[model samples]
Target: MRILMGIFVLAIYGGITFYLGWNLRTWLLAIQQFRWPIAYWIGLYAISFGYFIGKLHPLLTPFSIVGSYWMFFLQYGLILCVIANLLIAFTPLTTKLVGTWVISVLIVLLIVGTYFAYSPVIRNATIEIDKPGEDMRVVVASDFHLGVLSGKGHLEKFVQLSNEKNPDLVLLPGDIVDDSPKRFINKGMGDVMQQLQATYGVYGVPGNHEYYGNEMKQFREAMEKANVQILMDETILVGERFYLTGREDLTNKNRLPLSKLKPEDNALPWFVMNHTPNDLDEPANLGVDFHVSGHTHKGQMWPNHLITERIFELDYGQRGKNDMHALVSSGFGFWGPPTRIGSRSELWVIDIQFAK
Candidate 1:
């Protein structure tokens, strides 16, 4: 199975490299950057190799961080080039002109996209739930994906934003760290994590990427050192007013479901932390007061949000009926592009009232 997966990945990577190179072939030839065809081939191959590095981004560290931006440019640039060539399929205009236009536009978009990626805006939302008690302000955010590229600066900003909200409880759904939790510790994010001030404390779940590189041990250790509690299919009472149940991330098939993990004491307000928003019916059916999640990133980039829209009913916001409500965060941090074109990077400041 692993071998088959590897082959599948290789095939896709190869196809993308071939298509991008062919689409930009004329531009490559016209450029004096490479005096010889051999050098040109080397350069193209190096760029093409960026895709693989991106796939293994969690482990590649600082190099992958820089490579991620380039990969995004290459990805979009190729698509634009393909579209231009198709639009002018048989036109007499030289392909060079189309290529130049596409390249120029790609550069401009890259700058704009970078700015968008770094500047994540805070989103404020309020949802009401039954199970009477005192009002509570819960801050829920996820998909930080902090690693080589999305690093210290991003972490500092996120922590600051989360703290400034002054949420009673800070809930991290998943994908908190990218490559390795150790990276967070080594990169000073561990200290930042400790600075996240919440009366009820900060809680987290493990996302797929946390397990991607067999870094669960490191992840657990980081959480402990940072004073963040990781709840793997566990439930705990917070503030003696509500129950916070954090389920294992969707990545684990053996993970316990909401039915088993949710505290049977239905008197207290319940908040469920789930990484992926899929299977929302389960949480709703279980009578959860609020289900918080973040893996979707609301597609993160243009047209990508559309794909997520088709997949999740509550892809990027709040929705519920009666006693059950779900809040899906686009994410506090980001992945690949570090830019938010179609979607905004976000932290959800949830003002919760416990009135009957």
Candidate 2:
């Protein structure tokens, strides 16, 4: 079964690349006069993978952004192009018109997608809880991969917006740092985060990216410098009324289950910050008043959101069951291609008004 699944993944990836390549062939030939067609393809993949190299070394950070663009351009740009042309593929059209149509659609998608990627959309939501206390406004921002693709500029925007809202607390669900912690810190993410002001404090959890880049220590250090608390599988009392429970990412196999990490006294309303809104039935059943998270990136781009929606309980926006409420943000930064299509890059401003 494992081998079959591996083969299936390879087949899917291979098929997508093949179609993307078909769409890219016309452009490649147009540039064939340069006489480096093969080299260009090789360089494309190399640059795309170069992001990993930067994650491994702080000095290599500059290459990470370039790599990210190529990766998104090749992956999303081509995929959208192919999808757009599929309808025309079966039609009786001359080769000239086909090529013209394909190129036009591809260019449009690339341009529009790039715009969505850079422009973030702020999504506001208000939910009231039965906790007997004063109103608490919490701002949640997640998946602001802050290493290369998103740097000091994006970080500054996020912090400024969070502070401007005057939320009592700010929650970073996860993926706060893209990969290279050193790069993020050096680029002034630490300084920018310090600018964030909240009446209570700013708290965070680690997403798979934190573990994927293998820089846990560096990430912790960066968060510490920014004065943002990285919560593991633990719970903390906030404002003497809310129990903010933060769970470790699912990537950590040894992470304690929800039962073990949940507040001992479930009587107090709980605000849960979990990365990736999966298996929510368990946590919601635990009586969490408000569960905040982000990792899906709302598919980051199009169609991909469909996949996430199918997998998670609440892929984007707010949902409630029993007495618990969950909000999964699309995120505050672009993951790849610096574009957003069919989805918005967002910051979830949640107003948690307490009840009498």
Candidate 3:
């Protein structure tokens, strides 16, 4: 079944690529006859399949990066192509005119999205927990996805922005490393992360990407060495005030449940970080005062967020039920392509006021 599904998906992807290439050929032919049909098809398909081809080996990372951008183009390009085709069919508009407009609009969208992806925004929220503690400024940044595309420069910006907030607690929900932590460790990104200034400490949990890499020991060691703690299905009391419970990414079926991972001192305000915000009721039912997560990337692109909004209850931003406040970040890094449409890279500076 899985093999069949994979084949079906590949077929659909190939069909789309072919359609897009054919339209491009038609558009170019309208302007002037092109002779390199074989080269054109080869380049089109190669760029389309760059990501998967590059994924087969680490040496082809440049191909992977180029392919990742193509994936985004494929997504929006398909939509624009369809719309342009429809306009050409229904209206008196010529293919050249419609195609010109479509390509121009697509280019603008990609440029804007790339701009938003690189520009990180700080989102703020305040929650008053009915627990005794000093006012805490917690900075939550998730989904850094530090790999070939999002390099150490992005981490430096994150550290700089996070330090400016002067957060009491720095909580990274997940996806700190992309598919593998190789580039992150090899490039010394962890050292940049260590510069994050938080009064309490910096803590994070594993995202599905971490499992994808299957290098938990290396990822954890790198993080710990940088003073960024990776909590795996465990609860810890910080400053003897609040309790932080970081659950293993849902990818791990053997991970402990929210009930089992409760802090020894449950009376303190309990904060839970589960990489994917699939199960909110579990923590809410367990009386967790705050729940933070990432993984949706808020769809990470235009109209993609619409799908994520349906899958998760609170896909992005803060929500509340009684005293429990939950926040799901859009994340600080891009996953595949460094493009963000209808969403911007964001980190939350949550101001927590504990009850007197």
Best by lDDT: 3
The C-alpha lDDT values of all candidates are 0.80, 0.78, 0.90
Worst 10 residues of 3 by lDDT: 261-270
Per-residue lDDT value at 347 in model 1: 84
- Steric clash count of candidate 3: 0
Estimate candidate 2's alpha-carbon lDDT, on a 0 to 1 scale.
0.78
Q: Arrange candidates by TM-score, descending.
A: 3, 1, 2
lDDT string for model 3 (1-356, tens) is 99999999999999999998988888889878666999999988999999888978888877898899998989998898889889999999998888889889988998999999999999989999988878989999999999988889988999999999899999999999987888888999878988889899999999999999899999998899889999998998888788899999989999998899877675789999999999888888879999999999999988998899899988999999666899999999989989999999988999999888
The window of 10 residues in a row where model 2 has the poorest summed lDDT is: 26-35
What does the lDDT come to for candidate 1?
0.80
C-alpha root-mean-square deviation, each candidate: 2.4, 3.1, 1.1
Q: Considering summed lDDT, which 10 consecutive residues are worst modelled in model 1?
A: 57-66
**Of models 2 and 3, which has the larger TM-score?**
3
Ranking by lDDT: 3, 1, 2
